[model samples]
Target: MNRVTAWLPDRIDRRVRVVAWLSFLAQTIIIATGGAVRLTGSGLGCPTWPLCTEGSLVTTPEMGIHGMIEFGNRLMTGVVGIVAVLVVLSIWRIRRERRDLWTLAVVVVLGIVAQAIVGGITVWTGLNPFIVGFHYVASLVLVCVTAAYLVRLDAVPGPRELAVPSWYAGLTHATTAVLAVSIVFGVLTTASGPHSGDADAGRTGYNAELLEHVHAWPGYALFVLTLVLLVGASRLRLPVRRWVVVLLLVEVVQIAVGLYQARNGLPPLAVGVHMVLAALTAATMTVLVLKLKRPTATAAPAGDAAVAASAR
Candidate 1:
């Protein structure tokens, strides 16, 4: 155990940050790829769980391109699992000291496991819109969590001090709330729309056009709220102003993509881009939240026993 500990860095460093970035990137990539699978009508190419097909661990020739795409997506889970294991082990020696790190690492791994099960279920249920929507939303949640983990890695431990006024914090919370509602409506819009993963896949039975408009309401609200936050941050010279700018940019681009998709009758490429931007927007929001506060305590250097103890 000591040798293993010695082999891995006992403290957070560039290598640790690299792993953290990889964790975030992996989730984002998976979201994009999953979008591809659905847009391409490859959701059920393999037609079975655990194995690509019944009694087969790989895609068969008859399954064609769809099978390859779906199987490729399944294989990505293994890649993500490997990265999660690395993240856990890399920080194991400091697990007691950096409880936050190890705990989040475990959650990332467990979340992946749960996602795999959900994927299987989605396939088994013949891509029911609700379950499929849940699966997509779950991926966004994982992206958000991973983004938080990354932010925390660089943060000093202890209660964070607010960088902006208390009301600004409240505004931030409200923005997050509206963002959540918008995401839910967006998911519903997709569930009721034309891209049902498979040809015979069940839809949510709601009017897609109506859901689209409902989704836009909260989205516009988010944009206006975020604009207010940005102007306020800039005037106050708040450190989070930069992130707010980023958030606004993402929101604008996402809105554009969404508009294009709708106007074009929901082209697959536009939908895929919208999905990617949605994940990116979620990550950016997490960053904005973290940026709203500064750590109250100074972070100790990597090998300090006092730091280790405090982290515990």
Candidate 2:
């Protein structure tokens, strides 16, 4: 144990920060690649789970562009998995001293495994719209978790200070709820729209136009709530004002993308950009929520702190 501790960094510093950012970027990149799979109608390129095909483990010359695209996206998952493992291993020595970071790192590794299973199920179900929607939501949830981990890293080795009022915390919670609803409705809209990943893929069988309007309502509510939150944060001189502004800007850009896509017939490029922004918005909201509350202290038993201090 002493040797392991000596091998790893004793403190959370530049190396840890770089790994955290890499983990976040890996998640973001996979979202974009996943979007490519759907936008290009390549969801079933491999046509088999745990393998590219019945006898092949990767794309072949006969599989065509669709096959290659889907297989490529699958390969990207390996990259994410590698990063997840690195993040977990990097924090092993400090696990007792910083359980929050260690726990999140482990969660990220497990989440990637679960995501792989979900991806396989999506393929087995023949690209069911509901299943695919759930898969996207799972990615967003992972993004939120990773973002929280990143923000919390900055407050380590000390007691966290509360940065916002009780009411502001409640407001942040409300904003998160509304944002979740909007994302669900947005997924529903896509499920009912023309993008079914493949020509034979099943859709939700609802009126796309109606779903679009429903999604827009929550988005509008989120916009108003964020605007109010921004004003309140500014008036109260909370540290989260910058994050609020960022969230508002992301919301405006997403709204514009949705409107333009609706008018322009849901072009692949527009939808792709919208998907990226959605991930960004989720990350921003996560950081904002984490920043509003006090940082969690390492809950050591009676003599653990003294032991840790001596070890350092």
Candidate 3:
């Protein structure tokens, strides 16, 4: 049989790369628009799901600006879904040959579906803080997945081996764990804060001040851990140095934004920036962690091999 990729885009081909970038970009933008939705008290702009409201698929005039914002977000979701579906279909030629790429492609599309379901849950619960927090966390998870897919796109398909010393690997894992803790606390802190997506949404009973410190401690700790990773990467001359540096830069800005909002009564604009930076931080960290390994070696991709044999 002929090579399928002769007519279809390969894993790292221009079309696939563009679609992947769109997937990543869409995930990032949704977070920003989503923050706008919550901060502007338009979470319920449509006031119902699957139909926006009972028997109505679109926002009504009564919903006003809130309706528009929410409808815009829903439209964005459609965009994300279409892009995600494209990613999966684009790699059909290599789906069996390049499990790494196709698997991620599949996961991302499925994640978009799962996220849509979670979004519905957020509405059904009347923006319950815990459910809302879970919803944000789920979106962050998808961001991480999309970030990972983007990073892997730069590498060849093959088995991978640890490319660093054992201790260094341990440090990276620890760093990731610390980052997780920081993010979890940050979510809890937000749940306890004034921004609850809607005026009727209830907040957690925790004291915002105390939870803020709880969140800050882990964040500060994460920064320190990242510094250690950066230093180690520098001393060892590891290939991951650039990724670590990028992760550090994101952390710096994130922390500055966090501090500004903590003192300024958590203005909606600053808070939205903080949310965006947090996603960036998570995404960059994901890239760094992936950089820890390299393909043990490279071989001809299945499509290329097939084409060469066919020519012979």
lDDT of each: 0.88, 0.87, 0.86
Sorting all predicted structures by lDDT, with the top scorer first, yields 1, 2, 3
lDDT of 1 by residue, 18-54 (tens): 8888999999999988998999999999899989999
Worst 10 residues of 3 by lDDT: 303-312
- Candidate 1 residue pairs that clash: none
Candidate with better TM-score, 1 vs 2: 1
**Candidates sorted by TM-score, descending order?**
1, 3, 2
For model 3, residues 97-198, the per-residue Cα lDDT tens digits are 768878888888888888888889889888899988887887888889999998877665666778788898889889888888988889999999999989
Residues 97-206 of candidate 2 have per-residue lDDT tens digits of 77888989989889999999999999999999999999898888888888888986755345555678888899899999999999999999998999889999999999
Q: Estimate each model's TM-score.
A: 0.94, 0.92, 0.93
- Model with the higher TM-score, candidate 2 or 3: 3
Model 3 scores a C-alpha lDDT of 0.86
